[model samples]
Target chain A: EPEVTQTPSHQVTQMGQEVILRCVPISNHLYFYWYRQILGQKVEFLVSFYNNEISEKSEIFDDQFSVERPDGSNFTLKIRSTKLEDSAMYFCASRLQGSEGYTFGSGTRLTVV
Target chain B: QQPVQSPQAVILREGEDAVINCSSSKALYSVHWYRQKHGEAPVFLMILLKGGEQKGHDKISASFNEKKQQSSLYLTASQLSYSGTYFCGTGPSGGSYIPTFGRGTSLIVHP
Candidate 1:
């Protein structure tokens, strides 16, 4: 089955540095989302993107976070400045329609030091 | 808001049954179920929409009660392979596309 794919399975970055997590959603999927899970914590929603715009975002998705669908297949999340608290497993997911369950990528583990 | 999952963890023997509950304070449009094995991505199990519907996959089934804003997952005749962390993602009323997932219920089934 077709699945969501993310690049850089793991990343280590210095605090205050910018990081970009990339995802290639299923070719026919229309809605894309980003979620994060701190170690030993529940997965938290960050943002949802549709039609090249943000549909909704959580408080965790503050000024430092932005998402872009720079191309037909690529959905990218950019963090302007990384913090220790930002270190977590960032997951990218996509759904073809409002009715289907989402397909999530393996996830990119972001480590900030 | 995130749903509250009951019984943080449970252990069952093969051929036993298990029930995991998820409750939300706000009205929900839908509830999604996913299972994650250690160090692996969560795999979607099923989705239950409003109006108290139920969906199932093989021996795994789930129920969503819109009136009570609650959902439950039922694992019947469980096997060792069923061991994993199960999460319920809830989408609140008013078209919230982003579903908030609960902390998860860790279940272990031994042979």
Candidate 2:
């Protein structure tokens, strides 16, 4: 089965530093998404991307955060200023056209010190 | 709003049957089921759209009750592989594609 690949399985950064997380979604998927799971909390949606632009974003996706489909297959999430609370597992997911199911990447564990 | 799931956790022996439930306060356009092992990505199992439909995969199946805004996932003849956390993601009946996930139901299947 094809899989969505996320780089940097684990990353630790200073609280005020900027960080960029990368992902390669499934080749045929049309929709891409970024979600986060804080320790001991439910997974929360951050943003959804389609047609090379953002389709929808939650309140958690603020000015400090941005997403880009920099290349045909690569999707990225950049956090301008990481906070202590930003330490969490960030996941990348993709959906094929006309499909309700989403395939998620293994996730990158972001830890801000 | 996020959905609520019943039975925070469950432990069963092989071949036992178990059911996990999810309910939402808002009307649903679809309900999705996924299972995740510890420290791993969630694996999509099935999706139940509106119209109170039921979907199945292997011995695992789920039913949606559109009127009640609830869904149930049933697992039969459970195997060791079934030991994981199950989550129900609810999508509101609108253009919102982001589905809110429940807290999750943990299942432990013992020998």
Best by TM-score: 2
Point out the worst 10-residue segment of candidate 2 chain A by lDDT: A94-103
* Predicted candidate 2 versus true structure: per-residue lDDT over A21-62, tens digit per residue: 999999999999999999767888899999999989998999
Instruction: Name model 1 segments beyond 4 Å from true.
Output: B93-95
Model 1 DockQ reads: 0.87
Q: For residue B44, what is the lDDT in candidate 2?
A: 94
Q: How accurate locally is residue B106 in candidate 1, as Cα lDDT from 0 to 100?
A: 99
lDDT of 1 by residue, B1-111 (tens): 779998899999999999999999998888999998887788899998765799897899999988998999999999899999999999864457567899999999999
Clashing pairs in 2: none
* Model number with the top lDDT: 2
Q: How many residue pairs clash (N, CA or C atoms closer than 3 angstroms) in each of the candidate models, in the order given?
A: 0, 0
